[model samples]
Target: MTGGNWLGLSGKTIVVTGGSGGIGRAILRGALDAGARVVVLDYDAKTAEETAREADSAGCLAIGLGCDVSDTDSVAAAAEAVAERWGGCDVLINNAGILRPGPLEDLSLEDWTRMLDVNLNGCLIGSQIFGKQMVERGGGAIVHVASISASQPQPFSGAYSPGKAAVAMLSRQLAYEWGPKRIRSNVISPGLVLTPLSEAFYKDEDVRRARERLVPVGRIGRPQDMADVALFLASDRAAYVNGQEIVVDGGLSQTLMGTVPRPGYSG
Candidate 1:
């Protein structure tokens, strides 16, 4: 879509994990609209293929490859496929994650491990495998899709909070260790974004309004909000921006203390 002077991403190759839907899909669409070739790396073959077809139908260069982010072999194969097809990668968006919310005490060890495996470990795997390719090329960018849960704790979220918290630190570590190689690493923590997985919750008007109220912007976030940030971080515009976590929550996180008692304040 870009021909002259656009985000320095024209003709670049970007790989987005879990790109079949939700925020990942938005990122892929944003990249495609920015004239970048995108590869949808997802575990579900059907949805991945469907997404790829949709992109193609829209005149965007995109392909889908099934990948289980938690499995080493799966990630390696996906990287290899990208190497064979695109020669190498310019950006890697670690957006694949699983959230199994429940009380900590009631959550099983397996459940906790599963959450960490897909959320935290998956980031490491994708970064390591695809990062090596970037290191060989002497530079690249990685955008991890964490959540606001990483910073602010939420009750009944099992290990999701801990997993995302670890992902935040992991991105920083990658940024520090890989900066010398010119590879930039960053994090995008979204809050209250409606996706297929969470769309059902918004079915109730009261719940939707409640969520909007929590956000100081007076509305919930959209996938494009997070995607826009991801695109920025992936581009040269964010060359010096590394090891930083960008919260795309529409002023929600900043309102935590404000939600408390305000003796005489009644707006």
Candidate 2:
């Protein structure tokens, strides 16, 4: 089939942040393939437009808009535009974020604030803007793209982990407050997913194998792995699911303790 057959997202309008490429693009494509009219919200208008065109070619209604999630006015304007065009969004994938890796001690205040602003505050802003519409319309879903780092902190990752941790909590808070209106919110925490930005790191055979070894599944994750979870969270299939985080890390979290040397076990 030409379109996605994963869910009943046909004709639904979805707004995805940072959909110009990588995991964000994968999510956008998944929604489009599922027959949803998508909006690619990104800081770069050109790349967003390019992505939109590609989706449109696949017989999906897609648009690109430049938006800074940290800026309320920018987000409001984007929301207004979406409302005017698609009558309002049915789903929102708050996937915009940045990973500024550095030691917490060496990280500048500006870096920390920026990470929080984009990763945490960005999700809140998108939810509030689109979620208001969802509430008024009587129901909708918000899926956040938090990282597995949220729960398992990594050294030298700076504020990235902290910001994602807040995102997970933010999603839960929104779910608690918005569930009354039938608006569901959830978080998808991914681990070691291969994306455009990080593809180069995996080019080395040893590096790739080493990374894959860390996952109990014996392989790394793909963007589609996270996208599939996001689509499920946004669809009716997960109607009862809310205020929760679905870890898409190939059981890596489960093996954390096992990786440590045990008294009776041989390494």
Candidate 3:
């Protein structure tokens, strides 16, 4: 009864990328709430410090780090700092990404490459950089914040979907390669969350309601929904879970709208 909790993540040190942004903030808060010492690594210095201040107020051991995860040198420096401070990495959440929405024909090659670099390459870099330590220190967990777009194709969202798809696969590959060393890797794919970045779509009452109607749960997802599951995947509760994608989409993926729309509407 005096041992670690069932989840086995209390007092663990967690490194989270993009922790200054919407979903990233949610994840940072959630991880802290779970009794983890969290490092909020982000590209923006001000926002990172703000996040650290807020988390500190909540009695969480947190540090705001400014680093470009897409840059290998920057990531290496950050990793070194973390290693020097945290003893050894226990958990890493690769949540840094960009959403450059455009049709394939209209998508800029630069933007496409950037998306792949951040969304896909960022996860890979973080995993490999921190993963080496995880392997050496016995083991750890890696969670990638992939999107529901990875599984369900999105219209007008070009590079984002493909990059996320690769993220899913990348997680699986890491799990396979690092399983022997005890490092676990998994992906959490979230759907339509009400984050600030998503305000544009939800700004219109009709649009928000229509999109909600599409979800089987009759509502869109919240960041906490994904973060709760993230808490598990990162913890020992999911010790057997690896190389898998847990879709947190409010049951929307299973429900197809084209087939059923009540008895009144028909083509």
Candidate closer to the true structure by TM-score (higher is better), 2 or 3? 2
> Which digits, one per residue and each the tens of the lDDT, describe model 3 over residues 27-81?
7777776778888889986788788888787534888888888999988888888
Candidate 1's C-alpha runs over 4 A off are 1-4, 58-60
Segments in model 3 whose C-alpha atoms lie over 4 Å from true places:
1-4, 58-60, 257-267
**C-alpha lDDT of all candidate models, in order:** 0.89, 0.89, 0.86
- Give TM-scores for every candidate, taking all chains together and pairing residue i with residue i: 0.96, 0.95, 0.93
Tens digit of per-residue lDDT, candidate 2, span 1-267: 134554778888899998886888888878877888999999888888888888787534999999999999999999999998889989999999987889977899998898899889999989999998987777999999998889998789889888899999999999999999999999999999889888999999999999998898999899989988999899878899999999999998888678788798946
Question: What local lDDT score does residue 178 receive in model 2, on the 0 to 100 scale?
Answer: 91
Give the local distance difference test score of model 3.
0.86
Name the TM-score of candidate 3. Answer: 0.93
Comparison by TM-score, 1 against 2, better one? 1
lDDT tens per residue, model 1, 1-267: 232155888788899998987898888888887888899988897788789878777534798999999999999999998899888888999999887889987899999999999999999999999999898777999999999999889789899999999999999999999999899999999999999988999999999998898888899888989899999999988899999999999998898678677889755
Q: How big is the RMSD of model 3? A: 2.8
Q: Which stretches of candidate 2 lie over 4 Å from their true place?
A: 1-6, 58-60
